[model samples]
Target: MTDWITTPVEPRLLRGALDVERTAHGILPHRLPAWARKQFPDPYLAMVEAQPSGVRLALRTRATAIELDVLPTKTVYQGAPVPPDGVYDLVVDGKLTGRASVPGGNTHTIDMATWSAVTRPGPMGTARFAALPAGEKDVEIWLPQTEITELIALRTDAPVATAPRHGRRVWLHHGSSISHGSTAESPTATWPALAAARGGVELINLGFGGNALLDPFTARAMRDTPADLISLKVGINLANADLMRLRGFSPAVHGFLDTLREGHPTTPLLVVSPVLCPIQEDTPGPVAPDFDAPKLRFRALSDPSDRTSGRLTLTLIRDELSRIITQRSADDPNLHYLDGRSLYGEPDFAELPLPDQLHPDPAGHRRIGERFADWAFGDDGPFAVSGG
Candidate 1:
């Protein structure tokens, strides 16, 4: 076998990464450690949506390779008995590079650490580091089976740039499961990824699975981060978790935006309501089925008489948010609003239903991506396209 000579690294690699990707997996270990197994009693708990919920990093590199010092914003830990095992695919310059695996899917393997998880060998780890092929490059991170997470190359210095970079202006988005790319096939196919691609701009997604509840800390995070454009995909998580009432939601959204305004006073900020989800569209909240003790299953009881009690439909929330944005826009010209259905709606749901009835499938992600791109960056849009 002939030996392959390694390519030299370039100076451009030292700048912060031009893109990032999330490709995590769920592992159901055959053997569970006494201390690790059976963390959560429910079986569904074991499938803790292993996708990387959020990512933040300050990339640095020498003349050799790009350094990935990643800060995972959220990693779901269900406390199940057995840890899940799987590998995430990594691609650079439109080619498969290598894989990153969580051997045993240890829930505590990556504990609640604030420091970044630096994949020292860069996107492909150290195994096949030479495949990066030196020069202006286009990197894409693909999910194993679904399109739940993806990061596109905004800027690079590889041999060939398949996806060219626009301007430095970045559009940052924050949301719940939808934003987290639930059930989407491949990472690049997600709505946010699609939108960024269509607009040809960089993106910083802060979507957290089951975690977008108008949290003050998240607002602070947005305020503290740097961005040329900003948006918050709200309502779904609050409705799903049944965390707060309608009365509390309206004011909470205002507060969240207010906090971000402190940091992004002039930046265009768009607020997105929840996408269309039929199961709970009109239903006030989730009602668990009755569980018979003999079957070892728990059930939920919901009173049909109470419609508004549990239901926080997308239509209702979207309308309310629109009203709020209209009211606030008079004072804040930078504020904007977009209906969630514009991303995904009843028509799309009829074709691609979410497995859990709350999340979007891969096809649904494509639909969302297409619609969002058309609405935000299409010729008729209020927003302008960015090109470098």
Candidate 2:
């Protein structure tokens, strides 16, 4: 091991987190505040929120190399082969400069066949980035979006300090796994990150895989956070989770917006619907896992005939969402709605089909990100920068 100076991870260096929890092993960053976390203590919620979707450590240093000791909680599907290792993206001076991953951490194995799970302990590991240019420059080590990471230690050959703030507008975004960088090539390549780069804004991602269920705590979390602009990508998770019916969804959505508006009455709030998921477009869900194939796939389990009974589907949710936003927008001009299909519609799907019949691939992510930037941050868009 190389001799190096170690520094404690401080709050000033962290971006995109609402709070940090000090654990016996290391510091765990949380996108949801402690109060909100306390309210919903399910293991699933804890896992996804602690994954640090868009969180990163930003600082300035002249060190030629840096290392971060992390304890990651990796998830494994019991019968299938292990998933790819989670990735950490290193950004230098606002550009993606490197990528790395630790060797081992904790593991949570789930048997889709039985819907049972178990947690096993794993050893801590280190991620090191070397060959950085020797000069005082800004560096951001973006944590893994798919793993629950506890930052153990940060080491460098030279002294490190908090980097100067860029004074960019903070854009708070909430969505599902797609927004959580699910199939993106890397952390910074997630659609939201890509849009932030193109829009010249700072990002605080509240995207939690399999957990953006319009929870009251989430809306309250969004209400309390500081943001110049805000967005909600609703539908897919709700449908897939089969969380509620159409009647319940409308009021739940209205109540969610009401809570957010209480804190940000005039803030530009954009409500986005679901992108095309051919499986759930018309079929109602509680999506079921198709484990027969080598690669795990999802199938909408609810019947089309069930729609009359108020079962949720992408088409039904999108229509209700558009109506809700339209009605609300008449009285609150700051509120706006964007049909998600506009971002990834039929034509795009034909070119870049969702690999698992759900989440988009890397190319699809790039396409969605670019399209979003053009529409949401364009000259006539609601989030357009002044004088742009």
Candidate 3:
């Protein structure tokens, strides 16, 4: 580490976070603004937001080696194996060039039965990338999506400067864990990240695991952010949590769109429904976690004939989303819809089944990313470049 230039990430060199807080460790990034965070004191939202899904350090340097020291907090469920260390992806000159992970960090242990969690402090660790291609080039170190990281220090063999303005269009996407890189191999491999790369746009992912319940604060955050393309991947968390019924779902969606329009009046706003999850497609959930299975599995605890009789079927929800998008598109032409299954439908599932029966596995993430890039960023797609 000799002769390495060490300093915290400059705000201008950071992308995708709404705010940065200088702390004892270093810089802590927030995807949501302080005002929006105050509206929800729920621990679920707190933890979800703290994990930097789309946040990254973007800079230009001739440095052939880079190292970032961070304190990552990994969540470990009681009785389950300790979660793997979070991955840091290095992209050099727009291509994924290397990957590294910290060896040790804090652990947030969760008791599934009691739904309680306790965090044990651990040591700071380093993610080092060496022998980057020679020349002054753009480099991005994508933070781990599933870990809550407190950046401690940045050390590069040569001085780095903020990357100049990349004229690529910005895409702001909000969704559930799928969009958050759940089960993905690395940050850059996540569907949204992959699609953004293929689409040649900058990404600001607002996907929070199990927390994309159409919250007004989230909508407000999306509304306030500047973006050329915007998308809402709704319906998954709403049904997974059994949070609301069709009675409340439609209006909440409308209100959410209304808020987004307040800021991005005509931004290409794409609304996506839930992808194909056999367990949840026909059944509603407050899905119970089943540990005895070979792999972590889930069971839909409640039947459709239950209180949520006709309202929450994934199919029904998709239909409702389609109807809403169709009805709204009459006046708002930029409003578009994408069937979630188009991204991960049955045929594709037969090939790459979801490892957990809920979240897609790493391969599935790549498939979804490829399809999305073709469907959403390709010709005639919602976010397609005019001359591309």
TM-score per model over all chains = 0.65, 0.97, 0.97
C-alpha local distance difference test of each model: 0.52, 0.89, 0.88
Off by over 4 Å in 2: 1-3
Q: Please, what are the lDDT tens digits per residue for candidate 2 over residues 175-236?
A: 99999987888889899999998998889999988878889999999999999999999899
CA RMSD per model (angstroms):
9.9, 1.6, 1.5
The residue-by-residue lDDT of candidate 3 on 94-182, one tens digit each, is 99999999978888888877778899999999999998999899999999999988888889988999986579999999998999886
Which of the numbered candidates is closest to the native, going by highest lDDT? 2
Q: For residues 1-388, write the lDDT of model 1, one tens digit per residue.
A: 3233333222132112222222342111111122222343423222222344222111221212332212122233222123223234444533446554322111232221231222122132121233454444455433322111222221222232134433456787888767766445444555787677677656666665556678676677678777878888898756555667777888998899899999989787888888877755655554222233332221223333455643565556777899999999999887888988877777877778665567776677777877776777667553454310
Q: Ten residues in a row with the worst lDDT in model 1?
A: 25-34
